[model samples]
Target: MVFYALGSKFIQEKKDRENTPPKAQEVIYYSLAIGHHLGVIDCLKPQITCKVAEYDAWIAQLPIDGEARRKLEGVKRFGEINIDGTHTHLLAVALHHSLPQMTEQQQQWSRELIALLQRMENEPAIYLLVRRHDDW
Candidate 1:
């Protein structure tokens, strides 16, 4: 189980380093897988980050392809994306950079992962819209 988690991170990092457009999408997916394995979906929450708008703006800058963008669309909850077909890595990166304050139940390993990523300067812009991409 632990190795699975580590493997996910390794794959994510490898993709991130590639920094190509398609590779960015791959990084987003693999990172989310790692995030899910690490239980980040359960740890971060709607109320944690006051800067959802900022985070959303940052995410918007990434050249997310149509499929990945569509995957990220139509979500009402942060955790929902984990099961709703949105890329997990993108979700994890969003939570990490958003600096959301977690609930008591969520203050655990996930938080540590977010903090660690943040420490590594993995900052990106985020986009928050009232509706979906249509609202943008």
Candidate 2:
């Protein structure tokens, strides 16, 4: 479900890039990365052993610079040690970048995504699932 939402946003961002300013495009890229990280946390399953591979595929498709790439690499590393904390930090950074320029609808979606992240943060089962995998 989260993945679907992320995919939709990614498509929209791609389409919007033509009209978007360079700085705003950077925000969009960060937002996509944050969304992907959240999607990974949401999609974790005990039977799945290829989560890191999935993440790598997604990362490879992103058109980000070295700094953004490093930030995402940090997301993967920190997620292994602390999924909730890492997600919170990444989401906050993405939001800070994107919020000032977002349309009302975009802001609403961001709010919903933030709520979802908060809910997931409180789920111990999700944390355990994250810890069970080191492939990331």
What CA RMSD would candidate 1 show?
A: 13.5
TM-score attained by model 2:
0.32
lDDT of 1 at 107: 42
Candidate 1: where is the Cα deviation over 4 Å?
A: 1-50, 76-79, 83-136
CA error at residue 25 for candidate 2, angstroms: 42
Model 1 TM-score is 0.24
Alpha-carbon local distance difference test for all models: 0.38, 0.45
* Strongest candidate by lDDT: 2
lDDT of 2 at 67: 38
Can you write out model 1's per-residue Cα lDDT over 1-136, one digit (the tens) per residue? 0101122233335555576576666666555545645655442223223234543443353345544344444343432343222234654555454434544323443465344334334322111111222232
For all the candidates, what are their Cα RMSDs to the real structure? 13.5, 17.2
Taking all chains together, each candidate's TM-score versus the true structure is: 0.24, 0.32
Worst 10 residues of 2 by lDDT: 1-10
Give the local distance difference test score of model 1: 0.38
